[model samples]
Target: MLLNDRVCVITGAASARGIGKATARLFATYGARIAVLDLDAGQAEEAARDIGPGHIGLACNVTDRAACDRAAEEIVARLGRIDVLVNNAGITQPLKIMEIAPENYDAVTDVNLRGTLYMSQAVIPGMRGQGSGAIVCMSSVSAQRGGGIFGGPHYSAAKGGVLGLAKAMARELGPDGIRVNSVTPGLIQTDITGGKLTPELKVEIAKGIPLGRLGVADDVAKACLFLASDLSAYITGAVIDVNGGMLI
Candidate 1:
């Protein structure tokens, strides 16, 4: 139990098959108390319940700073202190540069970039005072490769911003005993489209990946667990690629 008796907060963790939820479950099994935050109140509570006892869920719109602050306070008040934060709240859009409307750009950037910032801000003070903490930010292979299987130019730009923000935070917060790192996942198969990926499309995508398969939510979650646990205690400002040699 690498995270035994620790308290962890995971954002955007409501979806039954999303990476955030998988991370939450993995952390919980490691003996950590989990705080599952999502935009949907009911879903958040339900997800937490699904994780079993000694966990909680809260409704939080990560794009809203006030909501982020409140969530942080509430978690600390109940769980005593936050030892890890997974900034996993994000959204993506599948559109070209010219096809991206103003609304589309705003929605994608706000949730992926702004949400990460707000949530981090909410947790830093406690981590700083405690003199130790870990933060795992979620990026995407799209940011590194300039495009992903389902995201557009705007999505890439947003995730790229996340990479920069995580690195900068890691550098600034290292002295305070807080580690900040990122996970860049490739195309992960989730319930995003309700199993709409045709078998032919899956085969075509797998052909390009050296691993001969698409990624699952658990693959990225395991990377996050490594970063969040003591295994990577000496690492910070690093970007762990969970893309299965997609770039190679």
Candidate 2:
């Protein structure tokens, strides 16, 4: 019961096989009331229901500051408190630098970088008032290594921005009793990577990893669980890499 009696909000959790949903499930298993936020209200609620009883799902376009504010308010109103927030709403593009149009850059950065900012902004006031909270922003191995197995340069830039933003937020929010951290997961097997790898390709990729396997969504979710719990109370402005030695 690491998160017993906690209330947590996770963005982009509607995707059944995604990291956000995995985190939601893990948090729920620990006795935290969970809110699954997604662009699609129905899907979000469905995901919540799948997590079990007493969880909620809401529609939130994290790119829109107003929407984020409203969603945060609704969650607090419904759940009474917010103990943790996971800014997991993000989008990635696999285009090369030469192929990145202005629109592509906007689409990539808006969801990954701006979304993290706006959502965290919406939740901070609540956390500040409570004087205790944890924020886990999702970064990527692409951000660290300058490229990825699939994501484009813009994706790297967006996730890299997330890392910087989380650190800054952690420094500023720590005094208020809020801890902020980022997770840089490597080549995770999720909807994002589904159908993109052949069995041979996966084996080749695994050879490069010390753990010899692509990361599962649960691997990252378990990391989020630790950060969201009191176990990480003293940690802030940290980047926990869940890459299984891909970056090493």
Give candidate 1's TM-score: 0.98
Tens digit of per-residue lDDT, candidate 2, span 1-248? 89998999999999999999999999998999999999999999999999999999999999999999999999889999999999998888889989999999999999999999999999999999989999999999999999898899999999999999999999999999999999999999998997799999999999999988999999999999999999998999999999999977
C-alpha-based local distance difference test score of model 1: 0.94
Model 2 residue 168 CA deviation (Å) reads 0.4
Predicted structure with the largest TM-score when compared to the true one: 2
Local distance difference test, each candidate: 0.94, 0.95
Candidate 1 residue pairs in backbone clash: none
Model 2 weakest 10-residue run by lDDT: 188-197
Segments of candidate 1 deviating more than 4 angstroms: 193-196
For every candidate in turn, the CA RMSD to the true structure comes to: 0.9, 0.6
Least accurate 10 contiguous residues by lDDT in model 1: 188-197
